[model samples]
Target: MHRLILSLLIASLAACSHTPSVPLYRQLGGPDGIQDIVGRTLTRVAQHPTAGRTFKGVKMPFLVDSVSKYVCKVADGPCVYEGENMVRAHADLGLQGSEFDVMVSVLREELDRAGVGDAAKNELLRRLAPSRRDMVQR
Candidate 1:
């Protein structure tokens, strides 16, 4: 009986290991989830006088779509992200590292609220890593 129980436990563990990792989009609730996070992050940025000015008059729809596309692709979804590369898109923003940090904080909060897991967050970070060069004015 003990041997049988041990075999069962091993099988269970093996099954768990074989289960594929969840994608960031699915973990965060897909399109709707990313929209929610983007909205919250935008609101937080807008509420702050200093940070708000950076995105003055910038509409959220475009931003949301781009984010959703990229995240979807990164998270193993089937969408193709065809948006402009970060350097070309944001090169003129004159953003600083501090400003980027603020955005990261707000992003984390929104993701946390949306129930994105740590693994998903890490994946998002990896996907967004390249944007740093373009996002930061140096």
Candidate 2:
């Protein structure tokens, strides 16, 4: 009886250890949710004095779609990003740290407006934070 109980305890512990947590994509409400967040963020970015200049002459629809894909993929969603890599994409923009900071602030605002929880927002931002190196040329 003692051996059997020990085996059962070990099995229970193993199962608990293997349980999978929800992915960030699903936590953010999947594709539709990500799309909504991106749309609102872009609208804010377009109105931002510093960030808006970077978007001039850019096609809004394509930009939106690409951003949606990129965010979705980064969040571990089912979508794959087909856009240009960050380095190549932002290479000619001559972006500054201030501009990137402004964009991130706008993104946080949009995420909050979309009802994203702090944990989810932080996770998403953490995933995106690495791109700053590529985006900030100045």
Best-fitting candidate, scored by TM-score: 2
**Best candidate, lDDT-wise?**
2
lDDT of 2 by residue, 1-138 (tens): 999999999999999999598899887879988888888888778878777898888888888889998999999899988879999999999999998998899899888888888999999999899999988988
lDDT of 1 by residue, 2-45 (tens): 99999999999999889696666788777777767877787788
Candidate 2 CA-lDDT value = 0.89
CA error at residue 3 for candidate 2, angstroms: 10
What are the clashing pairs of model 2?
Answer: none
Q: What's the C-alpha lDDT at position 40 in model 2?
A: 81
Q: How many clashes show up per model?
A: 0, 0
How accurate locally, in lDDT, is each candidate? 0.77, 0.89
